[model samples]
Target: MKASFAKFVILFTVLAVAGFSFYFLSSREEPSSLCPQARTTVSAPEKDARMKNILAPTEENIQAGKALFNSQAQPIPCSICHGFKGDSIGVIFQWIKPYARNFTCFQTMKDISDGQMFWVIRNGSHGTRMQAYKKLEDEQIWQLVLYLRSFSE
Candidate 1:
């Protein structure tokens, strides 16, 4: 009986450790180190030539941007690919190659300039499924940028 009890305790301890390990590893969010992301978009000079967001990140602008990101934008909403929380884990994220840009990752977002983001939003990226928001005025795009920035903040 003593030997059987010891074996049972050992088995329980191993199982408990394994269970806890799996839970913690799986539940944790992806690290910010998944950054310095590569892009095959406009030329460096062209991206640099683009202007940065002119609109400040005021509550009103951010709210407008949130609207666009959630559902108001044309073609499709940003949340469809970038996730509602900007985590890049949207419903269709699994289907997109290279995955979507994770705005929540400051390590990645910090490297992307506002002008670069503006150019991408206006012209779209070459290799990605991002579409050009020609219908959206420059100010609207800037608003969206403000909202995207809020995720990292």
Candidate 2:
């Protein structure tokens, strides 16, 4: 009877530890990062409208972008801070900075051009919730840009 009681105690301890672990992980906020133009309206000159090299949001591009969005390169998924659907206000992503843009918002995206989007993804915003993805390959950055652009009306 003593041996059986000890086994039960051990099992209960293990279960308690696991439950606490899950709660802590779920509650913790991800490390902070920011965009360069968080408060500035320093806009770049519009690039050539005839910029023939601009890639469209093709099936391949969107799919690859999705992979990157869902990737675990960092602690939390992009969806956690950017919203599972890549737009705040529409979804949750409560950790996003107050100055951050809502990806799914048409008003937010309508004014942004492809080149502007590409630069932000490549270099990240200075003082906002964005972080530079300089390590990501060029194509991958473009893919993510394309995917984010897809949310525009």
Candidate 3:
């Protein structure tokens, strides 16, 4: 009878640990995998427009973009909403509706042209929380585009 009681106690303890682990993991906020996102921000002409990034994706340029994205950009940093990994699960992800674009998603990023991204970065998305980064120069915006593209690759 003592052996059976001991076995029961061990089984109960293991089950309780497993249950707590599952609960803790599930409660944490995770990034949503919204691939192939249907973007309707830019008009047909704007979406298809081809604008070349004059600045090459050199290590320096990418680092500059990273800095801007993380904390240097005016108004607010992109990482506040886009997340450090560009996964769209930012610090304020729970409060945002329609979530920020997940740059890590190749299916969605592939459809977005450089020009489209440039336009959005300069002008901001009409319906989204993304604000116009007017302070960023065209070259800086291009650098940002290059850095954003790296998330998918």
Candidate 4:
């Protein structure tokens, strides 16, 4: 009986520890890092018709963006690369070159215009793991841009 009781106690302890570990790790809101200086002044192509944020930074739009970032993005989800919190340290961070874009870096985001962000989201960066989210709708992309910008703010 004593041996059985000891085993039960050990199992309970292990289960408790695992449960807490999962809760703490998953509950983390965002990761903070010192971002490198970037050329934030990327200009939007004049010919691109959707060069502005049509949707306001309302809760609904931001929520929609969050949803898209988490699951709805085509090719691959944004959270897989940019992180669920837009912190750049995503699940595939090790495999990506030059690292993912850290949307939380206010210094870099400060100079990047809404139009520039829209262009990047639609066209993707040329030399990075960021592929063009061409499958996403224009409005959906705009909502995502807004959600990403919130990371810096």
Local distance difference test, each candidate:
0.82, 0.61, 0.84, 0.80
Clashes, model 3: 0
lDDT of 4 by residue, 47-149 (tens): 5534668899999999999999998888899999888878787887656666777888887777777887888888887877877888889899989988998
Q: Whose lDDT is greatest here?
A: 3
Which 10 residues in a row give candidate 3 its minimum summed lDDT? 40-49
List ranges where model 3 is wrong by over 4 Å. 1-32
- Give the local distance difference test score of model 2: 0.61
Instruction: Tell me how far the alpha carbon of residue 34 in candidate 3 is from the true structure, in angstroms, after superposition.
Output: 1.9
Quote the positional error of residue 86 for candidate 1 in Å: 0.5
Question: Cα miss at 62, model 2 (Å)?
Answer: 0.7
Least lDDT summed over 10 consecutive residues: which range in candidate 4?
Answer: 33-42
**Of candidates 4 and 2, the better by TM-score:** 4
Off by more than 4 A, model 1: 1-50
Error of 1 at 49 (Å): 5.4
Q: Name the top TM-score candidate.
A: 3
A best-first ranking of the candidates according to their lDDT comes to: 3, 1, 4, 2
Per-structure clash totals for the candidates: 0, 8, 0, 0
lDDT tens readout by residue for model 3, 1-153: 999999999999999999988876675554544666556665426434577788889999999999999999898999999999998878877666778889999988888888888888988887789889999999889889999999999
Q: Using alpha carbons, what is the TM-score of model 4? A: 0.71
